[model samples]
Structure formats: structure tokens, C-alpha cells
Target: MSSGQQEHEDYPVRDEQNEAELQESEAGDEMKPVKIPPRPKRRPRKRKFVAGLLAAVLPGAGHLYLGLLRKGITFIFLLLLDIMALLYFSSIGMQINVPLLILLALLIPVMYFYNVFDALQAADRILRFPEEHDPEDGEDIKSAASARRRVRITEPGISFGVMLLAGGVLLFLFRQKPPWLQAFIENSAGAAAAVLLIGLGVLMGIREVAKNMMARAGKERRSRRIGRYTASATLAAVGTLLFLDWSYGTDDMMLLLKWWPVIPVLWGIEYLLIYLFSRRSKPGGTVRRARMDLRGLISAIVLAACVFIVTEQEHYLHLWNRVSLNLTAAAVDYGEAEGHQFEKPPLVVPVELNTSKVSIDAINGDILIHRAAVEDIEIKATVWVDQLDGVLAEAIADQSFVEVSEGTTIKITPQSKAYGESGKRQPRINLDISLPEDRRFDLNVRTMNGGITLQNVEAIADISLETGNGELILHRIFGNVKGKTLNGAVRARNVLGDVELGTSGGDMSAWEVSGAMKLSTAVGNIKAYDSGDAVDVSTKNGNVEVAGARAKLHAESLNGRIHVRSADFGGDWEVYSAVGDIELFLPLTGNYTVEGSSGYGDITTDLPGLVIDKKLISGQIGTGEFKLRVDGNSNLNVSKY
Candidate 1:
């Protein structure tokens, strides 16, 4: 091409190249990533009060807020079952285990309140913590140093309260003047040790609970609390050993020693739940993986060792082979009772009177006294003229349980002698008194080695009978019947009377009575069948089953279940249990308000309008008044009816 033509072409080519370069630069600018705006954190709804209120009314309702279908349904099902079971078992004549029933009852309030608090807390988190709601900022903020430092600790007042409680218990012992107290006082060391151990246990338990509430979720706090519990338990075991060896009889000592193994098992179970269930709730909670508390483990091992040592006592081994699978009755003594019974003349001694009181004293024989239409005093005895034998009997009777006074007071007493009246074989003289049934009279009889049978008797005054090792049978007796036995059953039937009977180691049953009844037993079942009037019954180591009882009811048991059925309910009823379930089988239409509590278990009921608050289960049925307490362990399946 010519020079001018070449210059033009070059200009056009250069211009085109410059345009392409500029266009490429512009495209590059368009392709560069844009600076995007960040998404805003979700603003949680403030519905804590509503959520908690719903949960309180019905367990698992709060979980529904989180759209947790399975959890919510499970909570409702379990809670409803707990309460329904209470009503069902009670109606079925207690065809179920008492402890299990009580445990189910206890779950009502526990789960109910737990869900309430849980819902409230969860609502607060969802509403107040927007940062935590964001996926990018999911990491939890570290807790404040001050928050960790603030801890709840047992104060000086708690220690003082512990001392006061100890003192109060001791005072009660003295005031009650129980038969066992005399023996306990004679052995001061054992009594002191028992009291000390009880105090220690109570104080430590209080301290531990407080520490748990105050302690932050950390290994150090857990270890410290474990050490405290272990130390307290060790002290209790040591004290128990000393007390058992010095004071408690061989049987009681052996039983206590064998039960020591339960301590470690319980401890292990509790710790297992704590560790296995512990989870990180907040983001900062996972800053470091939670470690097993070595100190706590060490203390727990020490506690186990102490329990083992207590259980493996040398003295208990000899009795271990004879370990009774069935618990012995508290009042009934096994193995033949070795004692001398003087056979008095088998005679009917009836003392007719200007005074409506009849008194008779005996050394050792059954006292059979019944009325036979006689108006005056009749001494129908084998005339083995008895004297208190003030000098000889007192000196000879190694064990005499007798007390009688002169005058219009009817008295019967036991005369015990290590050596009987020499060769007399004391004629077996039983009293069969004849009295006019038209007039009522005050009657009192007592015996040591034989039973007391009072039949076809009518008394204007309170009739009292006592025995040391024999049964008491009363038939068609009028007036209040007060009977006590140390080693026998107390039974009364077809009597228009107010019954007050107590036994240490035998069953007690009262049927069809007119007035209120009070029955107590230490180691036997108390059964009241088809009886009227208010009933006050208690047992220390046995079940209390009331098939048909009415009116004001007060029943208690320390180590057994309390089963009650009443059609007539119109009084203040108080029911208590230390380690057993309480089942009430009564019509729902009855007018009675129920107030109940469970310490370590659950309180549940199926009846509508029942309210469960934490450890409390309360509601009004008709409109009477009553109170019940179940001091079962945590998750204790017990509720007093």
C-alpha cells in the first residue's frame, strides 16, 4: 500500500485495538465480586410468661412452643400416667408395689414444675439473645467472672438450726418417755453417738443441697461437694458402728450392719446420672470439654470403702447365716421365751362393790374374767392367797413387771420370780368374775406371762388391759377399750366401744366399733375392717391397711405403705410416711380437701382439679380438710392419700 493509505489503516487498527482494551477493562470491572449487605439477626418473641403458664397447667405444653412433638407428647403421657396410677392402684386393693406407686405419684409435681421453669428459661433465651440465634455467631459468650464467683453457701444460721433440730429431737425423746428410752439412757455412749451421727447427716445433707444450688458447673465445685458428702457419710458410718456395738441388741445391730452396703450403691447411682446427663447448654459451656472430676471420684471411692468396712463387721458374720429373709416383727420375739409362770388356782374371783371399780392382782397366769349375772364381789379363786411378797418376790423376781394400788382402782399385776414359790407349782388360778350387766363398772386388768380374755363385759368407765407376752381378746365390750401388749396381737370384735390398742410386735385389728379408734404397732400390719368413727392408726415397720374406715382419719407409717378406704369423710385428716407409698381408695364425690407433699418422690393424682406444684400436690374435692407428707427419696414414688 501507498504511504498515505498505510498511515490511515494503522490509525484505524490502533483505534480498534484501543476500543477492545477499554471494553475488556470494563467487563473485568463488572465481573469483580460485589460488597453484599449482611442479614439481620432474628428478633426472638418475648413469650416467656405465656409459655411458662401453659407448661405449668400441662406438662410439655412449653415444649410445643419449640415444635418438639415427641418430647411434649412423652411428657404429657408420663405425667398423666403417674396420676392415673395413683387412683387405679388405690381402687384395686393395692395389687401393686407401694414404692413403685409412690414413685409414680411423685413424678407429677416434679415434671410439672420442671417443664414450667424450663419453658420460661428457654423463652428468655430465644427472645433476649438474638446473637445466639444467629448461625454465624453461634459460639456462646463466656460467663462473667463475678457470676462464677457468686455462690450460695451454708451460713452460720444453718449450723445453729441443725443444733436446734438435734436438741428438739432429744427433747422429744425425753418428753415421750418411751420404753426404749430408759435402755438408751443407761447406755449413754451409744445414744450420744446416734444423736451425733443423725446431726452430722442432717447438717451435711443441708450443706450439700445448698452447695449444689450455688456451685457453678465446674469440676472444682463438684469435687468439693463430693468430698463434703463423703466426709459426712464416713463420720455417720463410724458413729453407727460404735452405737450398734454398745447399745443396739444383736439382731438390730446385724440388720444395720447388713444395710450399710446400700450407701455406696445409692451414691454410685446418683453420680452416674449427674455425669451422664450433663450437657453443654450455652456456647461458652463447650470452651473446654468437661472433664471427669477426679477429686469427686476419689472421695466417692473412700465413701464406698467406709460403707464396705461397716458391712463386713466381725460380729455380724456369726449372725449372717441366720439372716432372716423376712423382716421380723418389731414386737414379736422369736425363739422360746424362757420364763417361769406360776400356776395359780384356776378360780373365778369376782369382787362386787359399793365402788364401781374391781381390782385383782396375779403373779403369772391367764386372767379370764366374764360376767355371769352376779351383783356382788365373788372371789372364785383356788384360794392360793396372794401377797405382793414384798420381800421374797422382789428379791427372787429377777424380772417383775407389775404395779397395783389399793382402793377403788381395779388393778392386775404380774409377779415374776427367778425362782418360783418353792415346789408350789403355784396353782393355775384364773379369775372368772360374775357381775351384773345392768350397771357399768370400771375394769382394769394386767398380766405378764399370759393372755387376758374379757367376754360379754359392759363397762361404764374406760377399760384398760395390759400384758407383757400374751394376746388380748375382747368381745362385746362397751366403753373405750385401752389395751397394750408387748409381744402379742390385740384383737377386738362385735364391740360398741372406742378402741385404743397398741402392740410392739404383732398385728392389730379392730372390726365394727362405735367410737373413734387409735391403733399403733411397731412391727406388724394394722388392719381396720368395716369400722365407723374417726381412726388414728400408725406403724413403725409395717403396713397400714384400712379396708373400710370412716370419719376423721390420721394414719402414718415409717417403713410401710398406708392404704385407706373411707366412705364417710368429714374431718381433718393427717397422713404421713417416711419410706412408703400412700394409697387412698375413696369416692371422688366425698367432701375433703387434700394437701400433700413429697420430699424425694412424686405426688400424683388422677382426680380432676388436682394441682401439682413442685413437691406439692394439692386440691379440694368436696370440702373437708387434710394434710399428707411423703418423705421418700428424690423420685420417691409415694403420695399419702
Candidate 2:
């Protein structure tokens, strides 16, 4: 059987066993896990202290530290751009100053993003390769050492302190002036100094406090806190300025210095105190969380204050002045001194009527007629000397007048002048009359520049009073009243008759009126309160406010708002405005034919009896019962509760 044959068979078996061993080795290699080295833990790098100091001085220096050359240059360019924009706006007569300010406002976000990104990248770079610390001095080492030793005394606190000192010095200098000068200084400089000191203190306080708080907070919360604080401080400053300006009539600069500087200084002090506390506390016991909740609360309070101020301003501007009755009339003639013989010297004819009716028409002075029970007419006539060279009062006292009529027709003329020992001209003669109370006759009175007031008068027919620049006041009157004024306000209170009041450019207010009230104004608002029966008010350019109106109300405005509240209407209610919104409030059971429409707005109605016309959605409201029309392109909704 041969040794060669056995060896060959053993060799094949040996090869087969070798192949199995190779496959087993390959399977074990697939199942085994490979050893991998752990990635080095990333540590944020500490930026060079010099870089931070430089950034504090000039906004983008930190980017330069991270070798972001283009960004650093861009920062400088933006700063220059802002300066140039400010100068350009100043040169443009300040009309475009708002646009420049808005541009600056937009730039703030850009600068913030740039600062954050640069700081993050700089930190990353520092962590990646920590600058080698050398015990032996080198150029970089010396530079870093010098930067660390550099003291920063130009911070906001230091600047504000310097300003405060300067202001105090100026105030002291101004206070050393003479009495008149001292008064002027007190009015201007002393007030200004006080405001400046307070403002500086507040600003420094807030800035220091925020800075300290941000340092204690982590990166994620620091920026948010700073932003919230800045916004809150700014709003507070603006509000304080406005309030001071309105109440005291101070200039904007004085107001700002009075209030704004105090916030920063106070905040800064608070921050310093907090930092001191943190430094004194045990290392692990110091709280590390950011004060985000506190900041949010402050922001909310600021917003609420702003809302309150806005609402208060709205109400104050809407309130109209109340009307009162104090009547005075005077008429003087200069024609007598010119030797012009007068057909009728300014006469005071007191006539009494018995029918609750009185009327007057004077060309230059006021004519006042109060209702009383008079049986006949009374006249008081006084004539003045027609003197050319004497004083007006002397001529009037030197002259006397003879009564022309006894019953109603009273006509008197001015007499010649009397010469004095000093050769001075004097007046001739005039008459004076006192009438009975129970007069109902038609009395005529006229005036040009004096106001007329009718109080507690009962007239069956009518009373007319017209003035050029004086106010007309009617109180507790019973009868139809007609009043006209050129440049003064007309006020009617507790009038139990039909009222027709007209003003050319002043405000008109009617309160506690009984009969139909018609008020018209050219430039001021018309307000009617507690009006009885139907009331009709119209204005050309001012707002109309009506409250507690019982009867139907018809109000029209050309350029302002119409606000009606708690009004009940028996007949139709109509309101029209050309350029403002109309707000109407009624009771749940208030019923009438309601019609409302707007030209370019929606009609909102809470009235149940409203019949809305779809096609004229911009023109009218309600159906056949009541109609209200408004013209604008705003929102109008009618809701029923």
C-alpha cells in the first residue's frame, strides 16, 4: 500500500483543517470590537484680557483678537457709518432725524449679534489652543502683562460722576449772582443741576447693577437680562420726561436729567452691592441662576405703566371745559372826540317785559337780558361831552342826558364838550336807567367784544346773545336760547329749553339739558352730558363725546372720534363721522331703529334691532328705526350681549 499514498491523503486532510481554522479566525475577527481613543474634551478658552478691554472701549476689538480681521474692520466701518449718519441728519434740518434714529435702532441688533458671535468664536479659539504661558518675559507676555495692569477709569460710572461734579460746580457758580440773576439761575441752572445729578445717579446705578448681574449669570441668560433692563430703563426715562414736561413745563433736557440719570445710578449701586454680597458668600453657597424672572416682572410693570399713561392722556384730551354764567358788558365811543355829532351815543336802555320774552341787538357791546316780572319799560340815559382833548372818563362824567322816550322808544344824542381851567376837553351829558323786575317786554341789546350770560331766566318766546370773541354762558334757563360766538367757547348748563349754540373756533359743552340741544363748532370738540329729549351735536374737526343721554342722539363729526356711552333712545339714533371711529354703548334692553354704516369700514353693532344692509356696508347701519353712518377704512363691529 505504499507510504506515498498515505502521505498524500494526510496532506489533503491537513489542508482542509487549515482552511477551517482560517474561516474560524475570520468569524472571530468580525465579532470582536475595535478599540478607539476617546475624543479630547472641548474646553472653552479664556479670551485675552486685553481683547475684552479693547472691546469694552471700542465695540469690535474682540473679533480682532480671534483673527477675524474683516469683522473688526466692519465694526469700525459701522461706527463711522453711524457717526456720519448722525451728522448728515443734523445737517438736514432734523426732519430726517427720526429715520436716522431708526437706522441706529436697527444697527443695535446687528452689533449685538456680531458681539455674541465674535465672543463665542474667540472663546472657542482660546480653548482649542491655550496661549502658552511663559515665566520668561517675551513680547506677547509683556503686552499681556501691560494690558492686565491698565486701569479702566473711563467707564460709564466714571463719566457720569465727572458730569455730576461739573453740573454741581456750575450750579454753585450761578448761585453766586445778584438777586435778579439769582432768580434767573434758580429758574434755569439750579433746576437743571438738580435734574442732572439725579439722572446721573440713577443711570450709574442701573448700569452698574446690570453689569454685575450679567457677570453672575450664565451666557444664555446674560444677554436677555441686559436687553430687558435696557428697554425698561429707556421706557421709564421717556415716561418720566413726558410727565415732568406736562406738569412743570420743563424742557426735555431738564426732564431727562431729572429722572433718567437716577435709574442708572441706583441700578449701578444695587449691582455693586449684589456683587459684594456674592464675593463675601461661601464659594459653593452663592446662587448661580440668572434673575430672569425679576427682569420679566420689571418689564411687565413698565408695559402696564405705559398703557395707563396712554389711556389717561386719551381721557384728559377728551374732557371739555364746563360752562358758567358771569355776564359783563361795556361800550365806549371815540367818535365824540372827533367832533362827530352822534345820532345815538352808546345807550343803556333797560326795558322790562311781562311775557317771559326778551331780545336785544347792539352793534359793538354785549346786551344781557335776564327774565323778571316787570310791568313797564325803564330807561337810564347818560350823555358824554364831545371833547377832543380831554380823557374819556372825564368827558363822560362831565356830561348829562335828557330822556327821549318814556315807554319803549328811548333815543338820546351826545351834547357839546365843557372846557376846564386847564383847557382840557370834557364830556357833555348821558342818562342812566333802573328798571322793575317783572318785565316781559322785547328788550334789544348788542355788543361786539363782551360775553353775555343768562341765568335763571324764563322766557316764553326767545333770547338772543351774540359776541365776537367772548364766551356765552347760559345756566338754569327756561325757553328757547340762541347763542353765537366767534372765537370763544359756549357753555350751557341745566337749561330746560331748546338750545341753539354756535361757535366759530372754540369748544362747546352742554350738560343736564332738557329740550332738544343743537350745538355746532368749527374746530373744537362738542360734549353733551345728561341731555334731555333728543340731542343733536355737530363738529367740523374735533371729537364728540356724549354720555348719559336719554333721548335720541344725532352727532356728526368731520375729523374726530365719537364716543357715546349709557344712552337710551326712544326714537332713531344717528351718528356720522368722516375720518374717525364711532363707539356706541347701550343697555341690553335699549331698543330703537338702529342703522349704522361706514364707507370703508365694517359696521359692528350690539343692537338687536339692527337691520344691516349688505351693499352699503360702508355707509349706513340699522334698518327703518335708527341710522348711523360712518365713513372710514377701519374696523366696525356690532355685538349683542
Residue 31, model 2: Cα distance from true site in angstroms: 99
Best by TM-score: 1
Judge candidate 2 at residue 418 and give its lDDT.
Answer: 37
When superposed on Cα atoms, how far off is each prediction in RMSD? 26.4, 27.6
Q: How close is candidate 1 to the true structure, as a TM-score?
A: 0.40
Error of 1 at 171 (Å): 32
Instruction: Report the C-alpha lDDT of model 1 over 1-641, residue by residue, as the tens digit.
Output: 89999998777655788889999999999999989899965555647787777788778887676443444655776565556555644443111223334455666887888778766766665565434332222244345432232111101124445544654565465445564655444447355755676576567667776765554444334422223454466556655665676664433444544675665665565566555544434334542223444455455444434443333433222122112111122322221223322323322334435457665545455677677666543334321223334554333333433333344544444443333434333323345556665656777675544678888888876787766667888888888887777778888887787888877778888888888888888789888877778888888898888866666777888888877766656666777778777776555666667667777776666667668898887677765554433344323232233
lDDT per residue as tens, model 2, 1-641: 79999998777655788889999999999999998999865534446666666666677777566555445655665665555444543433111223334445566666756665565656455454344321123325336443332211101125444544654554444344335543453245334534543464366447656765666553222322323444445554555554465458555534433454565565565455545554453345645332333554355344434433332321222121111110222223322323423223443454433233233333222334453344343433333334333465454444533334333333322233435444433332222223345443323333444566666666545655556556788888766777667678989999877888887788999999888888888789999999877888888899999887777777888898888775454566677788888777765554344445566766666555555575243222233354444444344454433
| TM-score of every candidate relative to the true structure | 0.40, 0.37
In model 1, what lDDT does residue 63 have?
Answer: 62
Q: Using alpha carbons, what is the TM-score of model 2? A: 0.37
